[model samples]
Target: MTTDHRTHARVAVVTGGSRGIGRAVCERLAQNGLAVVVNYARDAAAAKETVATITAAGGRAVSVQADVADENAVTALFDRAEQEFGGVDVVVNAAGRLALSPIADLDLEVLDAVLRTNLRGTFVVAQRAARRLRAGGSFVAFSTSVVATRFPAYGAYVASKGAIESITLILARELRGRDITVNTVAPGPTATDLFLDGKGPEQIEQLAKAPPLERLGTPQDIARVVAFLTSSEGHWINGQILRANGGMV
Candidate 1:
């Protein structure tokens, strides 16, 4: 079981837990003995399926529907966690939107939509997590290695994640004595719908080659890193961006 400062069973609220890497994190944390609050913006079916999988494994979980960008909705999301599992100890802000277009040609509307979900949503969730997570808790945000790679057609998506890295670092300092660790996990070319959606097979192969591991990362791979970051063993690691990219740099 994961260790809480109080040595009680910990609770986690994983935004975007309906599928992909977020779903993997929820499942892994549940296996580690943390009660999970699975948050989904729209995919209620997927969220319910995730909860069912957890419960079937003898893990406690409840699916919650909320747009991470909506303050009132996010507030209710956290309330459900508290009411169902006592209190929250970990929050993994995994909700994000990806749009591919060069900055010059990107529509302003598309930019707004990306920022609304990836940036504003992060802020809303982080604000609530900062206030709710118990001592010795953790808040992990998501970023992309593309922020460093400077990939073309990823302008809006990268901007949102770049802002997230800044928020993660500064918030770790802002929560100084609260004993809550805030960090970002920047993954490289993972094999998830979010990463594979529009890419061609050749492009995927080329990305898979960049990593010394010589393959695309699985959602489970990224989830394991998150599992550590939110656990007592990794609590000392704070205000850092861990790139779980198989040495892709």
Candidate 2:
């Protein structure tokens, strides 16, 4: 696709946009003529690099540091976006952390952190977006294929994403009078740094082969779908969970 930079671009705020899927989503939105507010939790340097990448490519972008789990920080993030880009047209909640352990072995601290970051964080961000979305705005949240497959050791993560899916529906109805759409993108096992750890080449190969496509997904693959969902073309889709997992069940 061609990247046509515009003088006055639409505004978008993306969480966890410093690396991996978040970075790709930011780049794709920028290429599609949107000024991106790239939000990061702790990786300021990486977030800056993402912003630089977009700017160098003739697209507009800025890096903002905010922990999604914190309501104050999330409020600050939206305030900064509005101050910088006028008003936000698209909001993507892709910032999340994954911890895998059997329910028996799970630590309360780990569970709490996961819930705060994945569940509470999404609520805060989505609520903020719902309040500020433009007339035809869009809100995209993230889920995982593990929710469907019920993968062992993923109970906590799945529970969080399940909450995300439920919230998407609730928020969509809550905004019935508005033209905005709220949805979820549930990606299957992709070839991301977060998904590749503790696994070797053979393990990676096995995971990739599990998908019908015979390969793991790339960040770009997911980003393209997200771009469409937030763009004018996807305006008709609302309160849906579109899974981009290379056809993995």
Work out the TM-score per prediction.
0.98, 0.96
- Model 2 lDDT per residue over 118-232, tens place: 9999999999999988888899999998889898899889989999988888899999989999999999988888899787999789878988889999999999999989877
The residue pairs in collision within model 1 are: none
lDDT at 211, model 2: 84
Q: Write the per-residue lDDT of candidate 1 for residues 1-249, one digit (tens) a residue.
A: 544456777999999999999999999999889999999999999999999999999999999999999999999999999999999999999998999988899999999999999999999999999999999999999999998988899999999999999888899999999999999999999999989998899999999999999999999999999999998889899999999999986
Model 1 ranges with Cα > 4 A deviation: 1-6
The candidate maximizing lDDT is 1
For model 2, give the 10-residue run with minimal summed lDDT: 1-10
Error of 2 at 11 (Å): 0.4
Query: For each candidate, what is the lDDT?
Result: 0.94, 0.91
Q: Cα lDDT for residue 246, model 2?
A: 85
